[model samples]
Target: MNSERDALTEILAWRRHGDPNISAVEAPVVKMVVFAVGDTLFAFPGASVTEILPMTTIYWVPGCPSSLEGVINVRGDVTSVIRLGDLLGVEHVTEDGRTAILLGHGNAMCSGLRVDRVLDVLDVLEERIQPPLSTLPERFQPWATGMFAYQGRSVLALDLGRLFQDYRAGLA
Candidate 1:
């Protein structure tokens, strides 16, 4: 048993490739939180998201745009909520109890994004994320990052920074 313990390092070295230039570092991966806004799927970088909260009572704000779903009280902090479908022109479906609020902070602002459901939290190889296609819808093209497929669904990765910037500037 002592001899076998001493041979562990040698066994590891034996598994290495002959090429010294190639290190054994694992592939880079990007963690994402995937969610749906209506039937359209979207994702946000995990680093940008602070927390996830269940759908709660939203206090309506008068004179705001339709996309602004009002605000919610989270741990005594007032967080404004937005509907991605209203901003993107995606169809809105009736809430079916799986809805959630993703608390995300972008470059310019922080808000709660109302999503239909949080489908998954994934760590995907960076290479698996593909650039947005030229045929992407005009509304999404502006705010989207690369996209990737997960579990038979095509999920569009969005840049929360840009979206927040635009939202602050009254673009959304």
Candidate 2:
């Protein structure tokens, strides 16, 4: 009984301070919110997503790019809504997109990405992500950071920073 007690104490001490011999290398993981746009599944890092809102009334902005669906009043803050399908060159399967994922990229540059549906949050190992598939349109390659399989489907991870930058450049 004393031997077992001693072993327990040793285990507790080891837990408090991890073993030095064990390589500390840990797999990189990112929390992402996966959503559907058209028939394709896409993901954005959770840190970039400020909020998820239901479809709301959007005030149209004349002369805005086709990708810009309109402006929405989010808690008195008017934010531009981007039609992700238009940007991805995919036909929106849903006539009325059901959700908007509010995304932010520093300096208060934020917008709501209209999506067909809001899926779930997933913790994805960075190594599991593969390069964008060759079959994807060339234009989409730049925005696709990587791809990974989730629940038997391929989810393309988007680089929100680059995407927003591209959008801003297009305005120039």
Candidate 3:
């Protein structure tokens, strides 16, 4: 029974002193959902995205803001749809095989952002993200928080809160 007790003590000692080779310091990562508006790639913080839905018929609401595409009936809940491409000054291409990214929740500024396609969800390291490029158009620069190189492609990280604020202010 002494041998068994010694083995248990050794196991406890190993557990207390974990492998020294494995560094505990990890770079901070930002979780985001990357999507395409045209050829341009944009990323939204993952927490802001509620759901992604396939393209559906959008009923136009007369007298609404030009940026707003229309309303969509999502599971019996009528959600307003925003033509993100239009707001971004991107050409209004035909909405073939588009996707809607539902944003916000109850009592928040809930709406759906229509995009050409959903690219991916990524955990990008914080250090890799740089400030929004000055070369971007003035209208688009304010909404873009940062930019990062992902898989050889430069992805712009959007600030949804600022975008929505500007949208409501009739800037978009």
Candidate 4:
């Protein structure tokens, strides 16, 4: 009975004062802005996404490439919108209530990425991100950095740097 009491007292004391030698290790988490282009889902680093704008009038530029959806006025700023589906060769989704513009800024430029819909904004553990699937589309493979699951659906994380770089080259 005494030994049992002593063990119980020790456990209570340990609970009151956790071991100082045990250092807490926090898992690295990446905040992401997830959106859908057609039936596929994609995400960008939250830090790169400056804003999420609602679907609005896009003033088309006559000479711009097909990937260039058009431009929109945000407050007083005019931001160019890139149709991700056109660039990545995904099935095109017409502009509708679910569409959104993710305003992302890269090293050299900033543009609004038009997506079919905005699915989620979430923090995903770094370890949760796995290498992209081999079956990924060729155009999409170049921009996909990693893949992770969100709400039972796999979401691909895109490399904003490479995407912007390619977009710049396409314009030239």
* Index of the highest-TM-score prediction: 1
Model 3 stretches astray by more than 4 angstroms: 1-21, 92-95, 102-107
Q: What is the lDDT of candidate 2?
A: 0.82
lDDT of 2 by residue, 52-126 (tens): 888888889899887898888888888888988888887776755565555556334788888888889889988
The reply for model 2, stretches above 4 Å from the true place, is 1-26, 95-97, 106-108
Query: On TM-score, who's better, 1 or 3?
Result: 1
Please tell me which model should have the higher lDDT, number 1 or number 2.
Answer: 1
In terms of lDDT, model 1 sits at 0.88
| Best prediction by lDDT | 1
C-alpha lDDT of all candidate models, in order: 0.88, 0.82, 0.80, 0.87
TM-score of each: 0.84, 0.78, 0.80, 0.82
Candidate structures ordered by TM-score, highest first: 1, 4, 3, 2
Please provide, for model 1 over 1-172, each residue's C-alpha lDDT reduced to its tens digit, 9 standing for 90 to 100.
5656456576677676444666667899999999988888899999999998998999999999888989999999998999877877887676778989999998857999888889889898899999999999998988989999999889999999999888888988
The true-versus-predicted C-alpha distance at residue 167 of model 2, in Å, is 0.8
Comparing 1 and 4 on TM-score, the stronger one: 1
The true-structure Cα RMSD of candidate 3 reads 5.1
Better of 1 and 4 by lDDT: 1
Order the candidates by lDDT, highest first. 1, 4, 2, 3
